[model samples]
Target: MASSVLQIVSPIKGAPKPIGPTNKKPMRPSNQLPQSLLDAARAIEKVPFHAEKHVTFQPPSRVYTMKEIGLEGCGISPIATSEPFQLFSQEAVQQCRAEIFSEPVLDKYQFSSTFTKNMIRGISAEDAPFVHALWKSPQVANAVSKVAGIELVPAFDYEIAHVNVLVNKDGEGEKAEDNVGFSWHYDSFPFVCVTMLSDCAGMTGGETALRTGDGEVRKVRGPTMGTAVILQGRYIEHAALKALGGQERTTMITPFRPKNPLIKDETVLTTCVAISDNSRLFYDYCLYRAELLQERMRLQAQWLREQKEAGAPFDTASVKKFIEEQREFLDTTLEQFI
Candidate 1:
């Protein structure tokens, strides 16, 4: 499948960077991974990562509270904007559209059953200032916080986006025959900022439908340029309604998972593991397991001591203390990942 070629636009030069503690790096094409890294990938070419059969886990019984999709419910709107909207500028929108259309999807079924073409600034521990600037904007941050009702920022704020092209064929039916992009599904990310660059005027379909907390699906079309929908995708399931009139929908989907200190530490270790071969990955994985186990043990010990001093029942308090200590450990352990 041939596609338009994407040009690696040099990241914005001389942009004011973050105030303190930055691990800055130059931006490169997503697929332009170093040859050495590509070669290293050969070790895991056919390696199967099997789970330890001895470990057992009971299914979690805690129920997630269902919330609606309006500003009161999801605390986010399907059509969203921010002050000094730089990412959705006409020039940027066209660039994003061209960028995704230029690249063919190496992995076909990345988004459930949808046929999507996407690109990212980078997807590693390293940072890309160009892409990060777009993510770190104050206006964007405010919108995100409002939706979450808490302060939530990007785990990889700048380069964490997946510039996408959701292609709904000309003659395709709105009701999908299978799950490909057409089926409603929850996103792995905590929040999803879906910016629609394609014009909805004269288009028959291609509405982005999201299932709300009330179990009703609400479909909204970005009828104008720069229209965006921000949602807690991990909570709300979404699907792209088929675009008719042979129109193609272009979107920049930036998935931002919550900032968890423990996940950051685990990511650092796992990233190191992936660099070598299957054997090295397994080694690093084991190392991480040990680190996490030690942290857990420390938390348990602390909780028991605290309970003894308080002369209180060791019930929810113990569990709560364990969780708090784990977060603190996660924050202090590894170097900053974002």
Candidate 2:
């Protein structure tokens, strides 16, 4: 439960396979909007928008600051070049982008339509060098540290590099519309920093749009290569503009937050999504209990086999206990996901 114990297991190997709605059922087009999502988006429209710009291409980069952009306390910084930025190099990031697009994107919910594969590999803040470098930079660190009021530690922080590779050529036809663009939603974190790593080519329509409380829509052209944008992640309602000109929009979305040290009922991954509500703790606790139960069952099974091989009485009660724990843990975890 402690942060030290939850250090993310080494980054998972092999890119995650695309996820989609698994049910084979077909979906009907409905014009009606979900009132919940609509309301959430509308709530974002009530905040004011402030834009900040910084033109720098070198280390110790300067961060432009702004006050309130939405009720969530969002802000933006337009910087020239994030060269030697705290994170990955231009070339290294380009390679990551290339690899992300090399494969197909899939829907995570396994619903009727597909969701593009935007991945967050397990990068332990403790061991992540690029992240460490970035956090160490006076420019990047000072900004966040000022807000957090504590000197941030790399290993204890929660950070991930998000790579979104959009299709510019429009290959999937109708299905491409599913990928048109996501609706307005806030992240689980309180704030986020976005930086463009490469030039968006062959696309015309993809824009980063934000709405102020007065219903004014401000479109921030995502970063040009090496440019950075920062905003409050939990309060601002924003979405990617539909990609235009047949080119895929590519960008890096990174979020920073303090690490939760307690062993909760949810996995670290789910925590990132549930941090805003703070309800993720319950889910994490359930998940941890479930996994522990599973391991217990596996060990019990192995013990029973060993007893039988030795011609000793197998502990049938132990195996029964395993089955009971597995069922209980699963039942609890499923409820949270639902």
Candidate 3:
């Protein structure tokens, strides 16, 4: 397979825009979860994460590329999606669940949005140490990067381990026809690692459907417990299909960006501002952009200095291009504040 080719496009077309600033304050779920489900989730013991024992990395059985999916040159990576692969051990998943259901995490992080009714996000190291450690683990990142075909790091601390939860009481929510869990839209991040925290043995029809560039749709199978699927979601129009028959469906979504600071980062917060704590979200976004900008400027300075020492004339065109790109990056960052 050919290595991924970077295709930079600003303000990704067809991306979902924020509904409004009304959701600036965290919106609680309209309906409370059943006590039984809460008990089951909290019953698991909390254990410190140990990469050697918790991470069970295994390559996906099959990986779909942009060319294969008819979306060649669409995103930052040549790979589009990977079949479900083992990523964490059952013990690790249990610990994550325990942390998610902990009182502090549940009270502060649970958020409701038009996209997903029951979600737990904004989890940091202080809120869920085990979950945080698992995502920050180099082993886990390397495994996800291998499948994504790019060296990647978490988009930012705010995006780590965002959990989407669905509970079907008495299997009453099962639908005979296919249903959409998350409406068709592109992700805000370049890549995402979605790991399942719920058993899917009894579930059916929980695949991710991708809209090909030619308007055709292709489905990728959903991950089972302790398994995960990686996708270059920023450029792919996709949706999560509802799973029927599962008592509970919970998945951890961790967004990622290229590890190289020079890589064009088109990450936008259009889909996040409304659903997140504006203060923290903005802080993380600005800090990340600043860090990337710092590295880029430093590299550019070094290159200019080296060229001057070699008696080469200043490359005005190249310098202008860099400044323009950085200006756009700064503009994009400013736009996210609202």
Candidate 4:
């Protein structure tokens, strides 16, 4: 389909909620994964990665020459108390945390347990101004752009701030979750900037670890508040370290990519998928089409009822014809695939 005709809604945040008949009967379990999901896994495995022996973090408030971190190196920058760092103040972080507390986190079933690791997407519309102001700073923008070899991507490029929270203070009762931290994965963006509003101080684990192309692993520590860490999203394999004890690890995870005029970068998922591989495109469109079909059926049924109540001409034949056409297409396509 043409890009203009198909309005892409992200499956990341607002996912497909199919409303149809349910089969109450219990079915046998299968060990194998779906072919489409397998295809997704395969694509993930094929992603190219490049890295070095060590990683570092600098002050994000100052503009670094290309000689220091190179035009495309991955590293971190601690929030400085001077000029540029003052842009990200204590009041800003507190306000963001407030919004985090207010917004509802996605449950295990709603999002992928493997990638998200039960982390809450803590940013909300209420925190947008602070987020926009902090991210749009020249120091923050230039530092990331140089390391990423790309021009600075504005906060408005992808409106929704991508953040994941890791809180282990509730106790080990939640230990059954294999890893409370995120699993290893690479993003689709050119670069992903991370900074801690709060750190995992005194915590056993919960470090943000990244692996290089030479098989070298580097563990980064965001020990203090306002520390910024930049990663080569599409190049390195990275994961959050699991928190062993009761500690709070709060960080802002923002992705940067070239802006798109067509696809709306409203939601985190839509923003990522819009610039990502076609595999995600297929997955999202499949779910979106199903949702659209369900809505079409509902609206048609409602129209028929209204026509009958008003004593207007009820075109039962047209409705049946539409149903037959959609059903035939869906059945044939599904049968061929299954």
**Winning candidate number (TM-score):** 3
Model 1 misplaced regions, further than 4 Å: 1-66, 69-87, 97-130, 157-159, 168-170, 173-181, 212-215, 259-320, 323-338
What would the TM-score be for candidate 4 when compared with the true structure?
Answer: 0.46
Q: Clashing residue pairs in candidate 3, if any?
A: none
* Higher-ranked by TM-score: 1 or 3: 3
TM-scores for all predictions: 0.48, 0.43, 0.93, 0.46
Ordering by lDDT: 3, 4, 1, 2
TM-score head-to-head 2 vs 4, winner: 4
Candidate 2: stretches off by over 4 Å: 1-89, 95-120, 123-159, 171-180, 258-338
The reply for model 4, stretches above 4 Å from the true place, is 1-87, 103-112, 117-127, 137-139, 146-150, 155-159, 169-180, 258-338
Q: Which candidate leads the pack in lDDT?
A: 3
Q: Across residues 1-338, which tens digit of lDDT does each residue of candidate 2 receive?
A: 11111111111121112122332332322222234322432343111111112223333344322233333222222121111233334454443343322212111111122333333233333334443344345555455444333332222233445545444334543346443375565554435566665555555555666655466766655555655555543444567666655434556665653332211112223223322222433443444455555555565556666667777665566556555645644674565454
Poorly placed runs, candidate 3 (over 4 Å): 1-25, 175-178
**True-structure lDDT of candidate 1:** 0.42
Between candidates 1 and 4, the one scoring higher on lDDT is 4
Candidate 4 residue pairs in backbone clash: 57-76, 58-76, 58-77, 77-228
lDDT scores for all predictions? 0.42, 0.41, 0.85, 0.43
Looking at model 1, which ten-residue stretch has the lowest summed lDDT? 14-23
TM-score of 1: 0.48
> For candidate 4, lDDT tens digit of each residue in 102-166?
32322210112224432333233333444544565555566556554445464332333455555
